[model samples]
Target: MSLTIHWTDHLTGIMRRAADPPRLLVACDFDGTLAPIVPTPAEAALLPGMEEVLRSLSTAPGVHLAFVSGRPLEDLKKRVPIAAAGFIGSHGLEMQGHVLDGVPGAAAAWRGRSPFIADAIRRRTEQLPGVFVEEKPLSVAVHYRHACSADAAAVQALLQDTVNGAREFRLQEGHMVTELLPAIGCDKGTALCALADRLGVPRSAVICCGDDLTDETMFTGLPNALSIHIGPGPTAAACRADSPADLLQLLQHVDAARRKNLRKGSCGS
Candidate 1:
């Protein structure tokens, strides 16, 4: 079945149904959300106990948890050994158990074609100096913060030119980095929607949290769910959580709330 969400207004009705609080399908993005934004993408790691908290939530009754990330599935597994919980990797390009409607079934096939691009970008930038490329399994990120202002500009121009003719991929700009990834229909938003559908939960029962441009994609078509913006953003449903630790604290609160509600339901029953 194909499912797509397009608004938070649908949440009001679900919130009403959830006055008794419905079962929740909670999802979050890694990197800027579950881990801090480090200087290099490779250096980005989850805060201590972050994975444990996710595991706890995944096991908690009334709560369903998933790690939705831009990083590849293998990389996420290596970094966050979440067992039995849902994993949505590669900016929703890939998922465990199910594939999203708009995403190509053979999408990962393109993963290998990008290293050549990464090497070329790296070789060119190495000469101009300071700029560097951090290659991931499914994508490559060009970072310029360590480069001199002039060198960074030169590298950016080269990147823009390199990506101009490629229809198979495009660039994703984030804090001091530009990532080259396959151009496709998958994104965090679609991934979350797909997960919620697979879990058989109403959109209102979903809560999504994140802290970057890639995360903003989850907000695009979210209906019947809390679209939480972690740091200050131009949206109304925003909540400010200063760091990854803060995000973990917030998840703890949600877990507690779900457990309490479940216990109450059990007692009343």
Candidate 2:
């Protein structure tokens, strides 16, 4: 069976024609890519077959899988319910297994942060008409999705200023929301690099797929790997698929290619 190769048109066919399917390292972004995007982040769930596919890919020969997300690791574990794969949470600030550190028991660490921040954000945003704030372990997201365009900018400005008092953290800009996180030097890219180094694999063997601006950092860590951008983003990685279904199809193609390479290697041996 043929595999889609639009990505190869721009870059080398390194991942497409591997002799032994070079130790497969697959990293993916969570929202909008693995899980269908929802109105509220809490409402998002994995696409129909994502768990099965992820499980299979993780157990597949020579393959390693990790979920790189801005969500907290504990939240990711609860939401996804997969235990074997590595997880990079809070944009890689709190990681587990091979990809992250500094958060052995993130629940405890998160609790140490000021409760006042959450309370303050909630109370202040409630009075702003259409703004809302969702507190996270490593960050707090001030969502302006429901606000009118006229009010959005004003609410955003107010929230930004409020978070500015959090001198230890920096603001992360996203769609309809702005998040505040620690000023740590880690991101999804850093997470991928840490994993690759721990696994002792060259960057060319990795395959990272994502759908947001934060994901671009992951691609930077894997300069030689196959990078697939699933949806619209400001980064240079072209859109490889339009939806989660398309992403599944693409994974099936890559798996088929790897299986074919394995068969050929066995026969040649």
Candidate 3:
């Protein structure tokens, strides 16, 4: 059974544990966690007041915030536009403003390969109505949200076959879209770990929030971190929030707790 949690009952404990570490890492998935899922990906935006809350949290002392998403690095930057926070894009394959170490030339190689792969998928699925290809720098997403049930299934099957026979790519299905990303040993979990390592924060000090199957990797990969799932489903997450509004409330509580701690420290000093 899925664990159902109340934010009011759990927020204080979560804040207490999160505040114990020297540094805290607050990372979240962008699309469904921060912004409501929309029919058109480009139309998705952060829920009202969330951008300000994130900005405040990002500026808080010893707290590092990041948005980890399947979107391309540039796209994520365009959407969030907070210079202080970090961004892990392309499902952890790309990091904004920095090159991933030990993956020398990976960016260039992926750039070179993406078009060909995207073109191939486009050619294969063009005849299917409502099937459109969204090409990113390091990945290609085949969105079939507008397709009929039969057409959607056919598109998925065809894409699966196309990717299965390929040597350097893999398929990731989410909602009504299927994405093809480079066959790399990285994902949201690894990305979160890398970010923590880069920031010198312990995994126990991190809190990851997400709302999809892709986010499950982060929840399972970081066993020490607090994981919160955004909607109803069986998940590895320890807590749950019913909607974006509920998530906003939880974040507001965290912000308040962190500020209170800071003020208390100041008064003691």
Candidate 4:
């Protein structure tokens, strides 16, 4: 969990997986992993050249790209806009490329409950300056990044209390926000795994990366895959990228590797 394994030291094997056999399912967390974390959700967007890198990799013959995020699916698309890329959004409650038709009816019903949850949180947090609420179709999030440290803790306590009182929802704490989503036995990892299975990618060829606690599901769920964690934190990922910029650099290399393999008409061993 201390993350002693740096991604730079394992470039060879990682690049090989990118260009080699079985086809690679590359999924990455959007905020703070693909794009730098911002003060507000509206301010978040991909960094320069990140879009091109992702597009290139997504179009590579042996590579498939997907964005796994806590944001809504439409918001993720609006932010990324990569044609070849697919999306798993709202912390895996809803996805673009793949549909979880088997998800429980009660879980699917949470979309209607989100408005009530968001309204409750907004009312409770209204007194705290800089505290705001974002309501997704299947989840509700209280963002306190702009609030004082004291207010952040208060927001967390309030969110935790709500989750404790509500059995159907679970609390998901991220960088500066707290979210509540239906406890439908689904998460980023499960969603990513489901997507990979649908795509026919083997466990060893799955490459997923992320930067938060929710992303930890992706890391632990695919231990055999090349899992990269962005930024400072104890993580279950196999390697670490110091920042989003570092992750972009890694993607650039991975894209190049895929291209090189395509040109040579052979896969890496």
Candidate 5:
């Protein structure tokens, strides 16, 4: 059974944890978490004032911010221009402008396979109306958001058939999008774990917020971390924020609490 808790009920506890560690990792998902999901991915932007909030949090002492997304790294960089924060892109297959650690030769191998799979997908779906193939560095997303019911079904069937016997790639389904990524041992959860490790912080010191099925990995993988799921549905997150607006409110509260604690520490010193 899943229980939904409000951010207010847990704010005090979170603040206490934030003060204890004197360090925190604020990791967030990009689409549907920080920005409202739009029909076109290229046009997505941070919710009003969210960029400013994130910038402030990034600069806060002992607070590190990160954007974890399924987007390609370059695309994510274009959308979120925060130089202080780290980025884990391509569903954790890519990290900090390089293929995630532990996958030494996997990056080169995936690069060779990516174009072949992308081309095969495009060839199979090019004639299907309303189907858009988005090519990433190590993956390809087949977007059916604009397709009618029949076309959408056709797109799905085509994708399933194209990768039926393929061993080099795997499929991931999201809201109106299907992604083909390299068959690897990485995901958002692993990415979060890796991030915490790299920062020399415990999972207890990390806070991760996301709004999709892909985000579930981070929530479950970092059981010790403070996990928040944006918008309702069954989730492993400790709390739920009703919408992006609620998420913003939660961030504002965290920022205020941290700053207050910092000032208090300075006074005592």
Candidate 6:
């Protein structure tokens, strides 16, 4: 939708044209994108070398990095270990630019309300074996990974009932998890656009990466940018990476390419 994609070893070809002052915004999802998907949310950590890779990108001249995740902003900041990278959590609700938030998706405005919903969900599902409800400041993820099939199904039904209409909340599904998010229209896609706009970066300079359905919104959101899908699955992303290691390699390519471009510019000057 913004720019065409060409691939060889990585996005090197595209990076080259973004210029020495790339003004690129590199945004990625956390779990299953930068980190291996663990059995539990609390068990998730960055893949080896990811922190360094992200840090390298964060410090690159004219390049901005961000983590646009379903987890709350506070939780993401604790895990990412980078103070420079912008964080958009709660699936685009928290830390999103005011431009997007000012729109109908001002779900960021409803942050404090989710705690009450989370408490009610905990009360309802606590007795169900292996059902865990993870609460965010602005959202709630009900993980049924360890629950029996019947119990998971029942929980799904209950969540569906809770968000049946265009109510205050909506049901968002992920791997073995169902999240209760604000019904606001914003998502990873809108959030990415807002970030780019806020940073004054063009769409052609954007790089979006993620691993699951929720990430599809971003791929669809930045159709012209370089979007990479991790793991084996059908994806709207123009490229595919095998794992977080593969992602690290790709980021390294972009990093090195940008630095090289900067050196070339310096020499020419």
Best by lDDT: 4
Per-residue lDDT for 1-269 in model 2, tens only? 12334453633354353334467778888898898888888898889987877776666667777888988888887777777778888888777765445563433455557355767778766766667777777677778887888677876676678667656667777777777766666678977888888877677778888877788887766777777777653564533566777787667656666667666664121
In the range 1-269, model 3's lDDT, one tens digit per residue, is 68657555687688786566667889989988899998899999999999989988877757788889999888888889688878888888878632233332554488777788789888888888999899888889999999999989998898778777876777887878888887777788988888888878888888899998899899999998988899888889888888787898888777776677787673111
Error of 5 at 206 (Å): 0.8
Tens digits of per-residue lDDT, candidate 4, 22-70, equal 4777899999998898878899989888998888787777788899999
Give a tens-digit lDDT track for model 5, residues 94-120. 778322333325754776666777787
Which of the predicted structures, 1 or 3, would earn the higher lDDT when compared with the native? Answer: 3
Task: For candidate 4, give the lDDT of residue 263.
Answer: 85
For each candidate in the order shown, give its overall lDDT on alpha carbons: 0.70, 0.71, 0.82, 0.84, 0.82, 0.79
Model 2 reaches what TM-score against the true structure? 0.85
lDDT of 2 at 248: 77
Model 1 lDDT per residue over 214-243, tens place: 777777667557766656545433344656
Once model 3 is optimally superposed onto the true structure by TM-score, how far is the C-alpha of residue 266 displaced, in angstroms? 7.5
In model 1, which residue pairs have backbone atoms overlapping below 3 Å?
7-223, 18-21, 203-224, 204-224
- lDDT of the structure predicted as candidate 4: 0.84
What does the lDDT read for residue 17 in candidate 3?
63
Candidate 6 lDDT, 6-99, residue by residue in tens: 2445455555643444477888999998999998998899998989988887777677888988987788889999877788888887773323
Candidate 3 residues lying further than 4 Å off, grouped into runs, are: 97-104, 266-269
Which wins on lDDT, candidate 1 or candidate 5?
5
Which of the predicted structures, 5 or 6, would earn the higher TM-score when compared with the native? 5
| RMSD vs true structure, all candidates | 5.8, 4.5, 2.4, 2.1, 2.7, 3.9
**lDDT value, candidate 5, whole model:** 0.82
Candidates in order, TM-scores: namely: 0.82, 0.85, 0.93, 0.94, 0.91, 0.88
Would you list the clashing residue pairs of candidate 3?
A: none
Which residue pairs show collisions in model 4? none
